[model samples]
Target: MILLLGGTTEAKEVACCLEAAGMPYIYSTRTEVKFEGKGVSRFGALNKEGLECFCFTNRISCIINACHPFAHELHHTVAAASLNIPKIRYERGFPERAQHELVHYIKDYSEALAWTENSGFTSMLALSGVQSIPHLRSFWQKHRCWFRILDRQYSKDFASRHSFPADYLLFGLPQEKEEEVTLFQKLNPDLILTKESGLNGKLDSKIEAAIACHIPILVIEKPELPRAYKLVHSQQELLHLFQHE
Candidate 1:
């Protein structure tokens, strides 16, 4: 049996590839999501110990990691747990950093907050997701900021627990460039904040919208993955791994 850690679109593609190849696997996600793949679906976050125990009990032969790039804790846990198992990381292709004068690439959330503070960007629009609310709490609490997150009850509950103002919350993902332009115009923020989530994350639309509106945008770079796991960027590369196994 194989263990597939998934939650991203790339994960769905990998599941499809696995199915086409007639491979048997168990697909796992941190939370319950709507999945229509053939693999046995399981949900819940797992620690290093739990992962190892599960793999052992299920007779897992290989592990495919197709999680989001910013899933830092889960990536670390997977790296630490499956030392003996062959682990393959299905990575997303990140675009080259934009060289526009209005675009700034930040290393992480801490540095992003500092940049905003030093630059006197009080009113901002954040497209970095609900999980970032706590990370940037220091900046938002002292200034005017709006966060765009999934229009789900869980996301709202998360914001509530963090004491984030409900009125400042925007629901749903960024639309087309024209719609995004309208959003920027309506909000009229001092700056725009987003992650280096690659094309799949609609980074280009955000960049274009910011540029069209002449709003400076701060992009948080994706975190580096552990060197222990082998990385494959396409479905073909991921499927190739099983051939040798």
Candidate 2:
């Protein structure tokens, strides 16, 4: 049986392909969401040993790693466990370089916050998720920053627990470029903070709005993946691997 580590859009597409091909596999997710896909599924996380054990016990012939690009720790776990197995690292590629001059790419949240502090951006709009809120405590305390987060219970509870200003917590993801522009105008932020989520992240729309409003963007670059793993860019490539092996 194949083990498909899924969560992203590419993973869903791969799932559809697998279902169509009548492939026997198991889908794994880190979070507890309603998975409307086929095949058996296992929820929650696993350590390196646990992952290897699962692979061995379930007889996972191959692994399709379709987790979020930002999930670096999970990637490492997958890499370590799949050393002796056929593993496919599926990733949605990010741009080689930022197109706009105003786009300042930083290493992580801390550096992004530091950039904001150094740039004197008092009012900042953070498109990065709630997980990053804790790291930006000092920045939030100092500046009038608003966080755009998902409208989920855990998100709300975490924000509340962290003492993030209720009014400053904007729910829902940005949809279109025009919506982003409207949001930018409404916020009137001096700078915007976001992560490099690549094409799947709606990065272009946010960048377009930032460019239109003349607001500088502080982008936290994606984390590095493991070196010794077979990597694929698209669903087609992943499907090809499954077919061949």
Candidate 3:
């Protein structure tokens, strides 16, 4: 049996591939998001030791890691736990960095926040998600900022727990370029912030909207994955691994 670590859209793609191949697997997620795809669904965060125990108890022979690129800690935990098993990293294809004058790419959250502080952006729109609320607390506390989060109670409660202004939270995902432009016009923020979440994350739309509104945008680049796992970019590539087995 395979243990599939999933959370991103790529995870669902991986699950679909597995189902098509008639493979038995367990899809694990850190959150309680609905998984309509075929697989035995499980949810909860697990540490390295816990992961090893679960793998052993479940008779997991292979591991498919279709997690978000920025899930750095979980990547390490999976690598550590899958010492004697085959681990596959189903990575998403990222677009080339936008070279527009309004596009500024930062290394990570800390640096992104540092740039925001020194850049004199009075009002900002954050497309980075709910988890970033605490990371950018210093800037939001002092400036006029808004965060776009999932329209779920869990996300709202998370922002509330972080003491972020309820009124400042914008729900839902990134929209088409035209809709995004309308939102940008309405918000009229001094700056826009987002992550390098690839095509599935609708990064292009966000950048286009920011450019249309003549607003400077900051992009937090995706972090590097662990060298321990084998990486594949497509469903065919992932399924090909099991062809000889």
Candidate 4:
């Protein structure tokens, strides 16, 4: 059995592949969003006893980890558990957009904010997820901004405590064209901030929205992690990996 540490669009695609290939596996989730493929075993956040139960009840051999990079807790604990189960982190690569000379690369969001301070963007949108709240709240609070977040409001409240405006955005992904267009119009943003979360982090629509609205973008590049295998942007390659396994 495979324990798929799922929470991204790529997780669903992987599930599709698993079903098509006729494999049985478990899909773990903390949110209400249902995975695409059926016949998946379900589990939520596993406690210590729960982990013991999981280890005892199943012959789980491989873990298909699809959680985001910033989700260090999930990756560290579940992905690094003491079992015979080998883990393959579905890594996220960079987007294919052409880099202009104007686009700057920084280590993380704090540096990104430092670079932007007083330089003045027409407007800014933060899509780095909640992990980026410290940099945004502490430094980039004065800018015209919007932030997409889950229901927890972790990032939003943090930003609020640090004097960020209360009227910022709280949203989700894979938006349609009209929705993107609507956001583009509503924000009238000139700069878009995002992370490099590859295929699973489905921000393609948002990118299209920004480009369609002629807005420039800022990206928080993905930080490299150990023991993670990156899948090339082709299924043939993925199949080759599976075959070698």
lDDT of 1 by residue, 53-151 (tens): 999999998888999889999888988885598988999888788999999998998888889889988899999999999999998899999999988
How would you encode candidate 4's per-residue C-alpha lDDT over 1-245 as one tens digit per residue?
Answer: 77777777667767777777877888887554555667565756775456647856877767777777666667656544666555676655556854554344457777677666646654677777765666676445555677776655555566666665667766676466578778778877667787766645655666666667777666666665555444433445555667788
All models, RMSD in angstroms: 1.2, 1.7, 1.2, 4.2
Candidate scoring better on TM-score of 1 and 3: 3
TM-score of 2: 0.93
- Stretches of candidate 2 exceeding 4 Å from the true structure: 93-96
Task: For residues 168-218, write the lDDT of model 3, one tens digit per residue.
Answer: 999888898999999999999999999999988899999998999999999
Q: Indicate whether candidate 1 or candidate 4 has the larger TM-score.
A: 1
| Candidate lDDT (C-alpha), each | 0.91, 0.84, 0.90, 0.65
Residue 127 in model 3: lDDT: 94
TM-score, prediction 1: 0.96
User: TM-score: which is higher, 3 or 4?
Assistant: 3
Ordered from best to worst TM-score, the candidate numbers read 3, 1, 2, 4
lDDT at residue 81 of model 1 (Cα atoms): 88
- In model 1, what are the clashing residue pairs, if there are any? none
lDDT of 4: 0.65
- Model 2, position 118, has a per-residue lDDT of 81
Ranking by lDDT: 1, 3, 2, 4
